[model samples]
Target: MARESFAIGTVRIRPGSARALELPITRLVTGADVTLPVRVVHGRDDGPTVWLDAAIHGDEVVGVDVIRQVMGSLDPKAFRGTLVAVPIVNVLGFMTGDRYLPDRRDLNRSFPGSARGSLAGRIAHLFMTEVVAKCEVGIDLHTGSDKRSNLPQVRADLDDPRTRELAEAFGAPVMLHAGIRDGSLRHAARERGAIVLVYEAGEPLRFDSYAVEAGVIGVRRVLATLGMTDEVSEPPARPSRECRSSGWVRARRTGILHLDARLGQEVADGERLGTLFDSFGKTLNAVYANRDGIVVGRTEAPLVNSGDAVVHIAS
Candidate 1:
């Protein structure tokens, strides 16, 4: 069967074969014409449409690498459904090496955005309308923000059977049953009856090869699960323990923080995960996990204030 042709603004592209296209946006102050870059691979046969988006937080580059590698390696002739890949969603923030847009708005928190709103909002709206609305399933890739690092994991509302199936199919090392945050893409997509998996890994502004490879493998696994591609050899055994709940372990006293644990490390109840020390090298307080769980995320910067989250544990 012949593939359908579509246009995002003035950019016209066909989808049966691998194609890279750009949807132009309004000109920015830097005089550079902003655009959303998308790569589409549509198979000749009809099947489920899946959209894989990365770099929603501009500083998260691991997903960008994964998208690149996945796109470069995929064969459209072998695919059954449409695979839309958006490598960088927040262009301004990506250019600045920051998580938020130049206007200080987080693109991830601006979903279901308005046609008439801030730059971030407009971009979010464009994505929701142009990319997301077209897909039956989505994989929104992300990484830890600021100075924090996250182990490769899938965060989703596993309460839903469909969502759980997708999360399991993702094959990440860990799966966290996280609540849907307001204005998040997953939340917005759920409202539209679409199941989207959020894959978190590495840290902002840094690329981890293992994390990238894992992401690529996970995405392909999802495609296979959706019948978009033939099942290849099974992926590596998933160290993936499912977490029923997760939360941040915050500091009780202000001081220099010293972390004794790493992402993906297991901690016991009341375990000393880190220590806070004064400028004079005197111990101020010891940080402990209140419950036994795996350290899914941790702050990399040593400085901390009272009430600051130092670790994120999932049980």
Candidate 2:
């Protein structure tokens, strides 16, 4: 058998070898060109090519560590197919710890980007052309934003059998069937026939050990499930729960919030999840679940405004 080789931009990676390459995006104010860093691991054995990208939202940094750990564990000689790991997708936002690019556009919503478009759009287009389009599957990692913390969970279009299988194989604590949002990487990737899974966990800008561990393990499990590798570093400790729908429990009035329910905890419909109290200690309101489900996400910040989302329940 002949050795297989993969190409991304000007870099060529042969089977049983690995290479760290950069794809140039655009120039900054200081005339410095920004680039996307990519690590390509081309296994000797023939199999599927998968891409793992994290930190599309610069503040969502947990996935960066997850990808690092995952990359450390993979060996090209023993692995199958190709593994493309990109720890940071939004270079500008990541540099400044902002969720959006310098242009204030959400990178997650600028997929299938155009070369002549905005910064986010160009980056998205570059990613789609140089990375995502080269793979058969993808795993886009993310964390909750806006002071929110999410229980380790996989959100994907469960209607697609292949995608659903990968989601189940990911083994996050919970799986939510999410729809494709316009301009999202998930939406663009699927349109191009790549089975993708979006893993959400932890909180933006803050590291959670459990969420990080779950994410690392989930990516490996999905790799095993795809036959890209037979080795799974850590099997899921518990079975994953599935939900077809979810809604947020919002605050009725602005105040300091006291949450009673925890992530991954089951809650019944109308159960009190938390309370809001004004500065004067007056009870403002009590937040309750609208349906029976697991508490998948909640705000960690104590201060909130009226109608702020407090809890996310998947039923």
Candidate 3:
């Protein structure tokens, strides 16, 4: 028998078909309805159901474009399984170019949300129910926040054999072992027996072509790896470095920052990575790497206060 239609929020999408939907969240102060936009592509063949979510933070928009490109390349008639995409999860914050919702809550930290809860909590709950609970695996796309740019990397609990395989197949430059944080979507999904990969790249509010391309290809490769699609790209020329641990190097002084290291640069312990400059051009303090590792992230803001995180190294 042919597969049954994929159902979400009372909408039934038949096999080899696709649909775009908006599930009502709430009404704005102006009385306009706020809703979550969802895209579903149901395949002709039976396969695992996977989801791709992005913009949980609103300003992290590279994933929005990534989803668009990836979906455009897929043919529901030839595809397998179902793909549920929530490209814009924080419409409220996204409209204002803010990271947090108007309620000042981080949407991502409000997972497994409630029916009778705060705005962020409600959205989280709806997503957990309507999207996550129905999928076997997913990719949570993100970008560096607060003016920092990241090298395209995958962060997950690499200890799991299957999870590790998926991360490796994604082929990001660095695969970091990161534990699930409380209230995070990853944590909630894991609790319910679903596996998720967090893909971090670029900086918020800007589209770096490389990061976008990397994410698009990575998603396609993962779909292929999961046996959900036949469109696959070759592995990245450089194998992804497996990072068991990573840390941030903070600024030692408040001043105009000048970073000497680039993303993915391998540096030794105590290497001078940058310098803090005073108005008169005098060096306020020279920043150095705290350990031997590859630079995966750094601040893009010109000024940072003392003890602010300046660079992230994965080793």
Per residue, candidate 2 scores C-alpha lDDT tens digits across 1-315 of 956589999989999988999999888889998899999999999889999999999999999999999999888998889999999999889899899988889999999999999989989999999988999999999999989999999999888888888898899989999988999999999999999899999999977898899998899899898887886766667778989999998888889999998999999999999889989889988989999999999999999999898899999
Question: Which model, 2 or 3, shows the larger lDDT?
Answer: 3
Model-by-model lDDT, in order?
0.87, 0.92, 0.94
Q: Pick the candidate with the highest TM-score.
A: 3
Candidate 2 at 130: error in angstroms? 0.6
Q: Supply the TM-score for candidate 1.
A: 0.95
- In model 1, the Cα lDDT at residue 261 comes to 86
State every prediction's TM-score relative to the real structure: 0.95, 0.98, 0.99
Question: What pairs collide in candidate 2?
Answer: none
lDDT score, residue 121, model 2?
Answer: 91
Candidate 1 Cα RMSD (Å)? 1.6
Model 1: ten consecutive residues of lowest lDDT: 6-15
Mark the regions of model 3 whose C-alpha exceeds 4 Å error after superposition.
none
Report residue 33 deviation for candidate 3 (angstroms): 0.6
Off by over 4 Å in 1: 6-15
State residue 155's C-alpha deviation in candidate 1, in Å: 1.0
In TM-score terms, candidate 2 sits at 0.98
